[model samples]
Target: MVEPFRVVDLADWTRGESEPGGAEEKRWFTAPDASSQSGRWLFKPRRIKELTLSRQRRARGDAPDLLVRGEDWAEKISYELARLVSVPAVETELATVVRRGTEEAVLGSMSRDMRPERWGWTPGAALLAEHDDDFDSELSRGHSLSAVLTVLAPMNGPVGTEFHSWPAFDVFAGYLVFDALVANTDRHAHNWGVLQNPTTGVVCLSPSFDHGSALASGNGDVFRADRVRSGAVQQWCSRGVTKRFDGGVAVGLVDIAMQALSLASADARRYRRDRIVGLNLDLCDDVINAAPNLSDHTRTFVQIAVATNRRRLIDALH
Candidate 1:
């Protein structure tokens, strides 16, 4: 049996916050790192504690900017993505549930004074406080196509000193593959990247982090609809092959992912064929079950999409 999830209490963070963990009290915070808000870590606390936790939630959204308030739900989502779908997403933990004796000032205290129109999340961070200055945003950071390619390349461990490029293209191919199986559509430019360790000559892709928005289509309001669509989805839903997502040509990671999905239909071969079947079977269950947020049309589209793209990928691979 699945263990009952515990609601995180705000008082766990500090004193003064009074709300219980029932209504608004059941919230997790994404503390803004000096880098990017997207880079923020998930902190599950109720009342008041660190000021860092307070600034994490914006006053305007009623909803969190990106971080989901309920840590329990978010953790499960991340786990399913990683374990079932094989996506290299974030490692989430149950930080702590502080049952503080204080009143509910944690909410009021952290409320921002910004205008509703002015409120927004910071997508990119110039630097991670613990890391070196070079990682920080400069005009140099967003300019080069090679620079974008470097994110997939292996770099130094943390400080990002060494330049050991990873089998970036392959890893990216893996991610695109896994994400497609799960019907995940949150692979925006901001969510994907590597946290380089300059010390070691290792450029590991940041574990495929942040997929809370993977199945959420309400995002059509905040972001571009196709921003997260798979190339296959784009092909079926939006007219034809899109260079924006598939890199235009029938190749690379997107192609590989689509083919993996198509393998579900084959009745021959032994090992590789079975692996594809398992992946497809798992993908169908996970996406259909966990995706309560998606519409019937959208979900069905994903189903057909995987098969269609699978065939596309197979043809390309052959």
Candidate 2:
């Protein structure tokens, strides 16, 4: 049996107000550990599969007490997967949030802030809006591949790190490949962006973040069990689509990933293709097996989905 992941309690950390954007509830907090190098972390609680009612409750100032899905585990797992595949991604940890002066703890995941000193994070939506005056960030109609590539063409890879030698679009292609492997359907215009320094005016692609929507996180155990038992897991994986990239374009996850690869340089195409083709299933199994509180059915479902998607992506690339 794999060992469980460590969960940090945020009761003692200095809590701040909630951060803006995204559908889930999130809050900013400063890590209290003096030994820790990271300064700020964003905590996102495991969201309920059904978010309409949760939104209503939040509007009414009530905390949701309904069934929370496995997004927290999905996030941590996605982080490990991205790291394994050499994708630039944010670091995430499983944690519990205990309100100040309260004993009850809320289960969630915390992502360390990746912004460098004197740099600000900007989402793709804002950049796209500026790139094209007619572009609407909230809608999927104008979030085209051509527009996104045009915005990233002139930028460099992530700053602060000398290891990244690729340009922004090349790295962005890797992000799409990672999304295809994990079936992350939430890579909307707002999900990705660039980091810019105000003083020197340097900009680069930001590491991939917000993967809670991946690996079938929103589905219930019954649905996963049924698909696994019925031997229809591949069917479900094939149906996975990223609606955020589709206005009426109607592209499958693998198709979109391949499209990005085609637009990328030969070096980037070879790099991402080699990574996908060389991905080890056993190591991926270790990631799935180690996720905290993941049911047997869910684990099996994720394994099959990833393996299926990997095959599909490889076939598409070939």
Candidate 3:
């Protein structure tokens, strides 16, 4: 089974106070080359990831790679999209970012005190000292796979997590539609998870996180038509869809839902298999049906993804 994990080290990034309680925040860091540091950290854990709002505001042409792409709604939009698409990720919540006082920075807690062994939490103390001079340059491998699984995981589980439990047919189909409408392309390893609560016996996947890349005003890597044109490539590289904030106004809610329809159509193979990835399909259907409160636009998007998935689900569920 895949183990539970969180980021304990921030030495590479600035030593900022995470949100109250356990909500992690991005701690800014200076790049070895001050200018280059502004780029992006290709691969990162979504729960503990950080980006500069101020830097995003200062951006010139294309949106800065590291900033939350949308405004305050970035989290809201992405979270709803995940629910619609049926991908699993961390719970999304707003948290504060604070630069730790010098005393806290210098006389940090010891690693042993932080308990790196139990729960697999790396100590937050020494991270400041050991982090790279160029912190943002670090990229995680297999981000492509991460993106695909964000919403379309195999339900068979990735290598790290062996337990697999996708839901009943109706539920899985509903989420697929939700994700397609939202166009959540940033489905990488750092954002999604596979785990269960022991007492509840519920092997639930986390809700979506790090969806700041959706619905932008310019062209982004994820928004490119060529990426999903070839059915095989969309299925094969479905795992790595980190959006580069490339969407123009044309690709908003309407465009995204349409794109999802086409993308899913190209590779019915993957969509057909992923209908019940994380939860029971019955529960999924219940959630979608109850979500009548979702905005009309969002609802329309879900309808499109689900309509196409129903037939496939019936054939497979039997």
Candidate 4:
């Protein structure tokens, strides 16, 4: 079982503040372009000097800041599960905020700015632009997975080395497997990217982030309960499709994973198969159960959904 690196109760951060001030203030400039109904704010806490110092030392940058999302817990759970499977994922914690004198708890995930002084970050969209002149329009119309693969497959090698000799393709394939297992439908162009070392010009796939849409985040408690009671978890999971690839075609997540796996080189396919087969579901259960703040109904639903998806993925490999 994987334990969260940290679990913060936000009440500590908001205790004395009568209103949103000090560290509770939002940094409006850092918001990324995405469709999230929940309000997001870049929070820099004043009390956690240790956290701030650690983030700065690791990234060789400033203090670590949190991207807090109101009324959302999916990111926290998703981060935990991703870490459990040894996938690169952002760290997250549950927090309570006092806004307008009303106390509410939300999920706050940590982020290291990709734009360090010496390094740079590139979104998948920019990477795709290297290959397709009409990348933007093509992306808007959907079915752009092939275009993305075309760009990423070639970046598999070490800097100044043979491009075809590396495992970057396999690493990305592993991400698809993670998405399928979690039923993440939002692996959009902007969601994945590469971290580039400006000094060396060496680029590697970025760690997975922005997973607020995974694990049926949009489903209500009542709907999730109904599905669980009816034993329709598998059917429901199968019906989970991604909007990232198909604008309106309703392409299933598992189908997308299968397609990506098939397109991958033999070595990449074998790597993904071994990784997925080796994941520990019991550890996943422990992580889910450890989230005391999560509602029982939601927890139960997540447990069943993960189990169903794991079986579905294992079956797909055969």
Candidate 5:
């Protein structure tokens, strides 16, 4: 079963003027470096007198601030599905905000700032630079999955002694499997990273985030309904391609997973495959069924699309 996420009715909060005290007084941080294509704002809720209550509402454990992005509900659904399958993902919530005096419900995903005063995180692109001198020039031409794997594989073995014992490689491989299952096409270099523990000197892969691009988020209800009614759901799955690698080349999401699996070590491969096998489609259906304000046509389309993609992923594993 998937864990329940806290849903905040921003409309009610705004109307009641009961939004967290001092929310208006708090300074919002700018995030120009964030890779999200949508607008993002950094928010920190004022600490409540009750400690337990404060922790519960906090985005991540002990982190006082969260990066809030304006997104479609796809990120919320993707985050829920990721949790259902036990994949590490950032926590998200559904919120309604008044924009220009017009109220609209929007999906807001909050990520804890990994840089907590001392600890620092490194983006995949920066990590890749340590291995290849021509990283920037090559990226300007086209980024390929093969190139990424080639750089990351060394961390798993005798060559990169610094990360030989770390679980970064395995975690990254699992992320690729999750992305494949969700048809996420935006796993760009800046989207993933590794966090360093300032006190313990330990390093690990960061939990996955920025998934608004997945699940055909750009598709409208009309397009999805037409595809479902025409029985072209399979065609839609086949047409789903990743925006990363080879200059956003059009390649099937499953194919990307297969390639990533092939490049992974035996242990990494097993980890990814096990996670994929553990996916609960029934829970997925329940999630779709419980989605708030979803149209019947969209619900049906999402169900079919998820089922088709799940089958394709499982079949590829075999």
Candidate 6:
């Protein structure tokens, strides 16, 4: 049996920095861990502001609804699932944040910074913009897979001992595969990028991050239950797409992932498919079942969605 993730209380931890550009609030702080490199972690609370609202709800004598948006557990579970398939991804942990004077604490996930010391993190939009003078990083109009691949083909995989010989495009294909499995529809141009060493002027792909938008995290419990009861999870997963790619047209997650894989080397393609083919459903169930603060409906819906998409990806890849 998989154990529940321990929740780190950050009420006393001093906020060191703030992260911008996302709809939700984010902060950077030094993690309590000793082994972490850089010691910097990003704290992103769940999309909903439940702490203050819950106090008001309680004052009104109503039930306080916690786990608003479910992104915290979604992020942690996605991290574990990524490990199951050997996808190099940023590590995330369940955490809580407290306002300075308030006793109420907001629940969130803390993502370990993937950037190595002295390396600069660059987003895909910036890379595309640099690659083509006409490309606009702010707009999604020109963020196509071909353009992304053309830029990645000449680069190396993420900077790590394990990724020494891997090509950037190869690892990127795995990222798409992971995205398809999770029904992630938010891989916009700003979502992915590379890390560059200032001294050597060397660049490499960065580990996948920012998965709080996956696994239907933004939807409420009622929506998840309705979809599961009506047996529409698979259909819903089929419709999940990130329009930020391929000229902003809505493309199915699985379709886009398969398209990316088709452009990769044969060995890399085979590796991704084999990982899915050999995946154990029970292990996935353990991960979901072990997740904290999830409703029964959410557990059932995510399990079915993953299994459904797994079948879809396997069929397409085979």
Clashes per prediction? Answer: 34, 0, 33, 1, 1, 0
lDDT of 5 by residue, 1-318 (tens): 434454443332212122232223222233333323122332322122222437566645564533222234567788788887666776555543443344433344433333445777777777766766666623433356666665555343211223246445565666777887777877877777666668876656667776766766556566677887898878888788775666556777888778877766787676667666777778888877765666777778777877788788888988
What local lDDT does model 2 show for residue 190? 84
lDDT of 5: 0.61
What TM-score, computed on C-alpha atoms, does each candidate reach?
Answer: 0.42, 0.91, 0.31, 0.71, 0.70, 0.91
Candidate 3 lDDT score at position 45:
22
Candidate 6 C-alpha error for residue 98, in Å: 0.4
TM-score of 2: 0.91
Full-model lDDT for every candidate? 0.37, 0.85, 0.32, 0.63, 0.61, 0.84
Clash total of candidate 3: 33
Compose the digit string of candidate 3's lDDT tens values, residues 1-318. Answer: 222122223355333222222223333232234432332221222231234456546664444444222222334434433544444433332222223464332211111111111223211111211332322212432222123323343233211222123332222223334444344454333434433344543333433344544333012323333333432222322232334112211222323333333343333335534543333444333433433223333333333333333333333333
Model 6, position 118, has a per-residue lDDT of: 86
> How do the residues 164-283 of candidate 2 rate in per-residue lDDT, one tens digit apiece?
577788889888999999999888898999898889887889999999989888776777889999999999999988878746455788888988988889998998889999999999
| Model 4 C-alpha lDDT versus the unseen true structure | 0.63
In the predicted model 5, the residue pairs found to clash are: 143-246
Off by over 4 Å in 5: 1-6, 9-70, 99-107, 112-117, 137-142, 150-166, 200-202
Q: Which one wins by TM-score: 5 or 6?
A: 6
Better of 3 and 4 by lDDT: 4
